[model samples]
Target: MIIGTAGHIDHGKTALVGALTGVDTDRLKEEKARGITIDLGFAYLPTPAGTLGFIDVPGHERLVHTMLAGASGIDFALLVVAADDGVMPQTREHFALLDLLGIRQGLVVLTKADLADEGRRAEVEGQIEALLAGTALEGAAVVPVSVVTGEGIEDLRSRLIAAAQGFSARASEGGFRLAVDRSFTLSGAGTVVTGTVLSGRVRVGDTLKVSPSGLSARVRSIHAQNRKAEEARAGDRCALNLAGEGVTHDAITRGDMVLDPALHAPSERIDASLRVLPGEPKPLGAWFPVRLHHASVEVGARLVPLAGDGVAPGGEGPVQLVLERPIAAASGDRYVIRDTSSQRTVGGGRFLDLRAPARKRRTPERLAQLDALMETDPAASVARLLAIDPWHVDLSAFARDHALGEGAAGRLAAELGLVTFSTPGARIGLSPARWELIRAAILAELTRFHDANPDLPGMGAERLRLALAPRLARPVFTEAVKRLAGEGRLALEGAWVRLAGHEVRLTRQDELLWEMIEPRLGGVERFRPPRVRDLAGLTGVAEPEIRRLMKLLGRMGRVDEVAQDHFFRRATVAQMVAMVRQLAEAAPDRQFAAARFRDRIEQDDHSVGRKVAIQILEFFDRHGVTLRRGDLRRINPHRLDLFGAIGEDAVNSGARSSQAETVSPDEGASRQVL
Candidate 1:
């Protein structure tokens, strides 16, 4: 079991722990020399209560942040109130924090009882009882113990064992997360990292990563509760000897943590339950500097009280603490808050959500909703998360918000049927009713796009991407689209897309324009279409109309754009391919140059000479119809016969085509053309 101690400085917190465990928790030289705990210390106590791992924190008012870092993971707390100066300033603050942290199982150890009069001790006990009233410790045992006299030490041990026996063993079978509380260098050893196992289990030789930095480390050795152990489980205080380049004592300071590679990430804002010290003068407001401690973190924060104008001193409220740096903390992690300037212990609380957005306070009701979450039940908390405006969330984001481990949030979502996990493994909001609404909206959008642009088969993927971009935003949105497509709700036709059954149509103008352009393609043997200006001029249609109509035809795949300025009737290109192949085989003497073939077939119809020769030759060449002779026309006989086919097929076949389709093909007829 994990045990933590809370109290004012010099109240025998360290001494009381030493008397109970026989280990001096004060490891610092200054603390020993000055007789005050200056930093966090650790000790272990093995009792019939099983082995209890003790985190001895500095009781100095300035170190309350350090104290908070150690508060949350324990099963119970040892509130060491001093009989000599019962209920000091830090004592009250500590008590308030305990209440806020929800640490219900604890015993009030009124230490230094020997230093107070019997009547004074009774009076302090009464004060302690009143202070703990209505807290988690309201009905807990308040055992008065004097470390010097060993008074109530045995009784305290028995009570601790009994309290611990009530706790079940932690489930160590999950993703691991360990918050580094101490880092030091041992002689002959490189770097030693120590912290309680917050979750999962780590064994010697296992590879681990220092989260936040994602630095890798080899677990050189593992020590559980200060004894060499093969494996360390959740709740075991462990020290790991590490080997890695990026990890160092300075880099792996308190608040930095180790987690399963998959479970590590940084969070910017944290939603938590916050309480102000009852003795404080005012409420905590937006961007107020406060020391925040959670998951071995001792850092200054900019407190942003949520759902309320601000929290009154001694009042409970909801707030978001914006850290100066990102931290590896999650929901349900208890934390302590204090006024750093005054070195005063203020109050502590538990995180309700990590990664709460930073929003300005505009509506009082909105802010109050956040405040109510702090006091809400589990189902209400889940409902609140679901009710967040713009309710879509990444699975990882949801996990961090609830402080649930890997897959835990997913399981919860499934259990509640508040969301659905798509086949692509993305979470999408989909309670049965919610799913129907979203589906209808999606289908309606597709229907509208199809109705508006019937000439095109569907919306372009880019257009769809843009439409969903705002709602999904980066990473998650991309995932959502893929999931939608995978589910067969949409069909992607090239760069264009549409809902599964959307069909293309043509307007009256488009139909007329297509009819005019259809004849310009000549016959099936002539695949090329006229240029945009040529077609528009010939058809008596405007260029803009032709361009828009062309886009529609192209989308339907009925027309093929063979060149940037050239549109081809698909059937015409197919016929040209057949004719070119037939002519190439039939003319053994003449090279099947476009100009030569044009001359032989119908030379006066510059249309045939112009169209078939040039267009078919280019189309054939594009479709792999060219010969490998150094010059193609020189090897043809039939083309040479047109000029002067005086030799055999081999020799005459080398002659160049005479009816080429250049601006002036006749001028170069006598010369060779390849």
Candidate 2:
């Protein structure tokens, strides 16, 4: 367990730590010259319980930022106050900052007891009690000690061990995210970084991502408390030697974190639940700049209150933090917000969302979601998440990014009966109520599509997805489709999806037109067929409607579209394929003349013209019917079976061909055949 020091500057905080552990914390040259703690120092004390690490923090008013970095990862605190001086300016500020940070364990130590009289020590004790009355340290033990006299030194040690008894190591199950407090190069070690392991575990030879810079490196070695270690778990102060192809010491810095690569999105706006300190002089207005500190990093940010126009002192509400620069943070990170001038701490918050919308952020729907977020339970979170997002949420990211454990998330999902759609590495979930709504919406859209264009096979998949939920992720949509198809509720075509049991059925006028158009494709005009414009003119139907019906027919395999504006019945294309193969030998490089085959088909079918003959030759070219070589076409021996076999006796010639004619229904020619 790591115990941090907090107090005013030169208040014997370093001297008190030295008395207990016999280690000089003030090691820096400037710190010794000034006779003050300029930066954070470390000391380790061994007890039967374990080796307790002490983080002696600087207490100067100007070095509060440095103090915060040390205070972020401590299990308990040692708040020092000189007996003669009582509570000073920085003593109050450091206490407030620790209270804002939610440090629940600590003992108030009144140092310099040898210098102060008994009455002075008693007076200082009263001041400490009043200062901690309502904070996390309320009713905390206060012990007076003198480093010069060694008075109460053993008693302080006993209190520390007692506090250590209650300290439990942080769980080592989440992603390993360590905020780097120091980054430097060693003689042989390429780059080394040291910080307390906030969560998860790290070991030698582990690959970690440094963010929000997006550089990755392999852990060459690890050290815990100056001792070489193969692995270090959460709550252990660690130092890592990193090496990789492009990793350099310059790429890393204090406040940057090395974390699991999965969590790397840098955020500039955060939606958080904030509580303003009650001691503020006035209410905090919206868009007020505050010094944001979390995980050893500090930034300038403007708070836009979402609950009201402004937040009264001591009032807790949801707010949006628009940061001046991006920070790699996630939901549930605890942070302290100090005033921009660094006079004092203003408030502290728990992040609810890393990516918050900049507009309409105070809507009732959004506020309700924040309420659910403050609950800090998985089931409530899932329900609110499903309610707000039309598409499902990526539950893995939802839980991890929200600081919810994977096991708890799984239990809540099972309890809530969430419908899950999954692909490799991702599982997206929706509430049962939301999923039913989605199913209803999809079926309704498909019904509308079938009603409007009954002649079409089905709606395209991409179109159906966009119509249902335009913002839905592609993987989630694909999983939903597969789920529906597996349940036999939907059928998937090549590129179209439709309700099961859906079949193409044309309108009455379309049926009459089909009769007029079908005969044209079956006889001498089979190779050329009839164009859509001619069919519309022949039947007096609109050209657009005719084209729709023709496409519908093509989908149903009633017509083979042979080149542009060319159509043939399935049987006609089949017959022509046979004649071509019959004219060529079964050799691999067999060639046939396009003109000769065109003449033979024209003679056999009694058809005429370039449109019909050329289209037929081109039709054979496509479908591997034959490979075109200028005037000649070669038979693809592999596809000879597609030609089918025909008896020579059945290949009879037609005397006259059908005429391509057009008529108007108003002219009493509704039944005109082309």
Candidate 3:
């Protein structure tokens, strides 16, 4: 167990540690000369339970930031109070910081008991009791000891060992994260960094990334609890010997973190639950500036209250933190906020969401989301978030933000029985009930659309996506549609989505008109079909009626609109594709010129116009059936069946017309022309 010392300057915190472990934590020259702790110091003690690590922090008011760095990951606190100086300002401040950090397992030590009588000791005890009245350390034992006389020293040691025995080991289930506090070069060891392991485990030869900077390093060795070991886990004071490119003493500093690469995402905005200290002189303003410290990293931030204009003194509420620069953090991490002047502690809180948005932050919906994120349990938070309006969560991002190890998210998803859809970039999870609701909504929308527009084949995918409620991402929506089609519930034809049983049919009046137009466009001269004006004049139908019926036929996969006004039978288009394929095969380089294609079509019908042949090749180019470069064109082998099944019999006898009706005009056209 790691124990951190907290009290005012000259409160004998260091002296008590030295008495307990026989090591002087005041190693700095200035500290030795002045007889006071200046910076952080370290010592270790071994008992029957295990090793007890001591972090002796400076108690001067100006060095609270340094104190905070040392106290960030301690498993216990040792509150020191000099009997001669009852209670001081730094004592209360340090005590408040300990409470804010959620360090509950500790006892109070009243040093210099020999300097005062029993009445004086009793008065100091009263002050200590008042301080601990409503805090986590409220009924903790207060032991009075004199380091000079060594009175009650052994009793204090016994209590510390008992506390260590009762301490619960932190679970090592997350990714490894070590907040680097000290980095220096050792003679035999190239570079060594010492800090507390926040979570997970790190073994020798394991590669870790220095977060925010993204520098990679490999661990050469480990020293846990001041003893050489092959590996170190969470809740241990560890020293790592690292060696890699750019892994130098000066490259890494006190605030940086060496952690798993998956936890390298840094963010500048954070949403959190904040509380203003009751001792503050005034209420916290809506836009307050403070120095935010978390896990040894300190950065300037702007505090914006989410719900109101300001948070009154001692009031607790949700707030957003906008940092001056990005920092690597995880959910449920506790943080302390000091005033901009760095004099007094304003408040502290726990981080909820790291990727907070700058806009719409005060909206009720966003506030509700923040409330759900305040849950300490990650699974509970995910469930609450999924229960909200969107009813879907990005499980991959959630796992990354929480620093969960591999397969953690998959296990949680299975435990929750979420209906999941995966894309290349994200895995989205939705409740099974919500998935059924979405499926029903999609089918209902399709049925309503079919009732409204029976002539059209189906709705475009993008249009249907926009028309749906609780809009999903494009990749996720595409995956859902593909899943539905795979289950035989929906039909995904080209870019259109429709019910499996939905089919477009022509009306009686339109069927009669199409009968006349089809014969005109599909006879001996099908390659050079008549335009809408010519077809209208021949069949005595209005030009607009001919155009409308032709468009409907195009949707039904009966014809292809080769040009603005020209239309041809789907079988004729398929035969033209076959002719192009044959011409390309006959060429030396598998490429044919437009003039050659025109000549080839003219061989079929002597009256096929040059303009009509050029138009057909351009249409093929637009539909990815042919790749054009300047004057040469080549048949796209992959798109051979874009129009229909291609064969000599089908081309010569026009036998694929009925089969071609299943291929939509917009199908298989995603590739660009070469």
Index of the highest-lDDT prediction: 3
lDDT of 2 by residue, 1-674 (tens): 88898988888989888988989989899999989998878888889777788889998888999999889888888889998888999998888878777788888998988999878888899999999997788899998898999999999999888777877788887778888888889996678988888888888877888978889889999988667899987888888999987777788888898877777778889999888888888877789889999988899999999987888899988999999988877687789999999878888979988878899899987887777677666567767767784446677777667544335445445655666654567667777666667677777888899888776777877788889853466776666666566666666643467788788877787788898878866655666666877777777888888778777787755666777656677677667777777767643567776566777787766655655677777766776767877777877764543323332122111101211122223334223221
Per-model TM values vs. the true structure: 0.73, 0.76, 0.82
C-alpha-based local distance difference test score of model 1: 0.67
Residue 607 error, candidate 3, Å: 15
Error of 2 at 256 (Å): 0.7
Indicate whether candidate 1 or candidate 3 has the larger lDDT.
3
lDDT of 1 by residue, 559-589 (tens): 6566655676655544444444456667775
How do these models rank on lDDT, best leading?
Answer: 3, 2, 1
Model 3, 543-575: lDDT tens per residue?
999999998898866788999989989889988
Once fitted onto the true fold, the runs of candidate 1 whose alpha carbons sit more than 4 angstroms away are 169-174, 359-384, 400-403, 417-426, 448-453, 460-490, 505-529, 533-674
The TM-score of predicted model 3 comes to 0.82
What TM value does model 1 have?
Answer: 0.73
The CA lDDT at 111 in model 2 is: 90
All models, RMSD in angstroms = 17.3, 14.6, 9.0
